[model samples]
Target: MTDSTKPTVLIVGGGIGGVALGMLLHKAGVPFEIYERATTVKPLGTAMNFNATTAVMMKQCGVYDEFMAVAKPFSAVQVGNTHRTIDYKIDFSEQEELFGAKGFIISRPDIYDLLVRQVPKEHFHLGKKVISSEQTNEGVILRFSDGTTAEGHILVGADGAYSSIRQHMYDQLKKEGRLPATDGEPLPFSSLCLVGQTKSLDPSVFPSLALDESQVMTVLIKDTPYACSIFTTKKNTVAWAVGEILDENRSKEGEKNEEWGPGAAEAMCQLSRDFPVISGGEKPLTMGDLIDWTDKDYITKVMLEEKVFETWYDGRIVLLGDACHKINPAGGAGATNAVHDAVTIANWIHALPPNPTKQEIESYFEEYKKERLPKAKEAYDSSRMFKSISSKSYLGWIAAVCFKHMPSWMNRTLLSSMMAYRPTVSFLPDAEDKGTVKPAHQHSLETRRILKERQEAATTAAVKA
Candidate 1:
């Protein structure tokens, strides 16, 4: 692509979605820059899961091998009680046969490192927090905290739930009386989580680490507000998480605006350190044991919010991932959905014409929302469903029982619907469909195939001449 035709993209937020979008833009040869508020990237959070759909996307992005190297294939989730005995198991053994790929689990930092390595170091501008943003007829500009500026043809907010770009865009829209009431409302979170991964340890001590496949053991303390989960990753390190159900009416003031603040992590870790865990051992284990093995710097406390905004884009600025839809972490679809958002938006951006007008850009952004919003809403609901089963309320216990006794056929049908919408980059060759179940129709892929045929025909005619 010529420089004249390329639209320079400015991505705010260097998290999974932002970096993943950067990598996709890099593959398309589009000029882009990523601005992150933090001076350094730290490995934070717990385990992240990749279903078959996301695995296909990883393969398309040329990072699947690296991802697999640090990830373990996930087969089942065992829900246990205070006695260290599993109450029920959600088996995923049929995932390979059903989706043509095994689901994998990796630590959040490992995946982030894998993604950022794909993009050039020069593309990232660290410690440049976007204080505000503006857009005129020509392009968009971001004003940073350091009193500097960045100009680009388009601005993307991959900056998590409390996105600066979203705030700036919404402020302008509200002044113009275009912002929706729901969009203007504050993000509400009902649960808080403390998550971290242990340093690589001897597999002999942690028997779960010795297993080839991933094992997720979650222990729910009955009648208590606490739940603890442990997952074994590829590097012989165990990813651990402690969740506490918070009052919906809890004070929003003094809440850490940053997602991975260490102060909150440390406090929550101290409170839940004695929480019991089932670590594939004859003797009982506690979250404190894993905490002792983990680096304190990597621990994070995050408020799990659930919301999908009514307004996603206005003019040249748009939202992606948690910026627009904040899914509950309990569903395990947050990262996967964010990656989907990145891939879909990248396709639309690649389809943009040279020297495009604001109207044309807005049209493509609409197409992106049209394709992604429903999928995101579905994921949001699924995440909430999972969250309910872990709550301390009576409904939570009933939901858990229903889930445990749910018919196998019914469960498979529900999963199939969730897994059917695997999207790939339109500018790249489509990944071969290896599953028996046909995937849902993707507009970008359809356009990709049409363009490929036209390009091939043009090449053939030129050869004949």
Candidate 2:
């Protein structure tokens, strides 16, 4: 295809989704540019858990090897009360053996760096925030905050939760009287999460911690002020996130702004004093003993009620990732689902006929929506449910106690479904199928072969030494 005929995708936001999408399109021989709102692509948040689906996409983007170079692998997930062991520990090694791939816990910047390295420097324009976009019969026009304009065949609102492109699309649809009515009240879960990170703990003392350089470790302290602590180790640096559920209504209405309000450290400390965990073979557990409370800083995020837009596509512009669906981070599925959107879109666009018409593009967008919306909703609902289950008062405590005694197989089964989810589009054959979907195992086999080769080479090097 000539330069003029090449399909151009204008991706908003330089976060994980946008950059990963750009990398996929580039690998597919498609021309695209990622316009990031940030002045520079720096590490934005703490760590993120990359399940199997996203790991497959990262592998396809040719950055899986790069990720393996720096990321740590999670062998098991431990969940229990502060004082005693829980039966809910999940050992992913066998599952990884079964699936032929392992999950990774890496810093957000590590994945971003891998993607940015694959993309051509010229194609990524930093500090170019998209202000508005206009769809035409031929293509779409994007106007940016820097007072510049660029036209492309399609525009992707990978800009994230507060997407300007999505707003613009909704406004245009409303003007044409095609928008859907607002759904009832937002999600009922009103809680704020304080996310923060700290210096790596000494592995000798915190032997239970997964400091494997790539594994993500989650500690659920029952009947404690701290609801959960999610930590992922990356090289010498270890990233941690602590979340305290808050009253969402009060935070939203601007009633409470204290750094340590109702569900702050002090409250957690009080809870710890009430329910002591038997640690180091001792009694009367303290908050300082459980976590490094003094050294860590926390960022408070009031969990907004979950809001799913009535629609994700308008004419030629479409929403991807957090732009269309916002899920609670209780399950760490938001980032994974967002990355899946990027891959799904790229695969759909690649499957279209060469030099397709505008109608063809719209059709592709429709198919993309039909396939992805359910999966996005599933992740959203699962996050809400998990949060509800985790935060129940008395009944929740009973269930949590029961979960501690559940069989290992049951817990593994539950987590496997979430961690191994692959979009429907990823399994399609390239111009050679009768449309029957391939089993997920086939893809797992491919991943296994690659991983095995890398392992063998490592073993050989070690033996030589």
TM-score of 1: 0.94
Model 1 Cα lDDT, one tens digit per residue, 1-465: 367877899999999999999999999989999999999887788998888878778877777888899999988878888888888877777777787788898988889999999989999989989888999978999999999999999999999999999999999999999999999988887788888899998876787888899888778977688889888999999998888777655525326545345466777778887788777767667888899999988877777777899888877888999999999888789999999999988998887766778888898889889989999999988887777767857777787887789898877887787788888888877677688778787776555654567578879999999
* Model 2 C-alpha lDDT per residue in residues 1-465, reported as the tens digit of each score: 445556788888777788778877887678888888888654545677776666555555446678888777776655555545444544555545444456777767677787778889999998897777898878899898888999888889988767888888887777878887672223344455544444555544444343343434444556543554445555544454445454544545432445445556455444433333322232443334444532333333344445666588766777888788877776678888888788778766765555657787788778777767877887887676555544646655665565557677776666555654554334223222221222233222232344456568879999999
Colliding pairs, model 1: none
Error of 2 at 336 (Å): 1.1
On TM-score, the candidate that comes out on top is 1
The segments of candidate 2 whose C-alpha lies over 4 angstroms from its true place after superposition are 1-3, 82-87, 90-93, 183-189, 200-202, 205-226, 251-305, 398-402, 408-416, 423-465
Give the TM-score of each candidate: 0.94, 0.77
Indicate the worst ten consecutive residues by lDDT in candidate 2.
430-439
- Each prediction's whole-model lDDT (CA): 0.85, 0.63
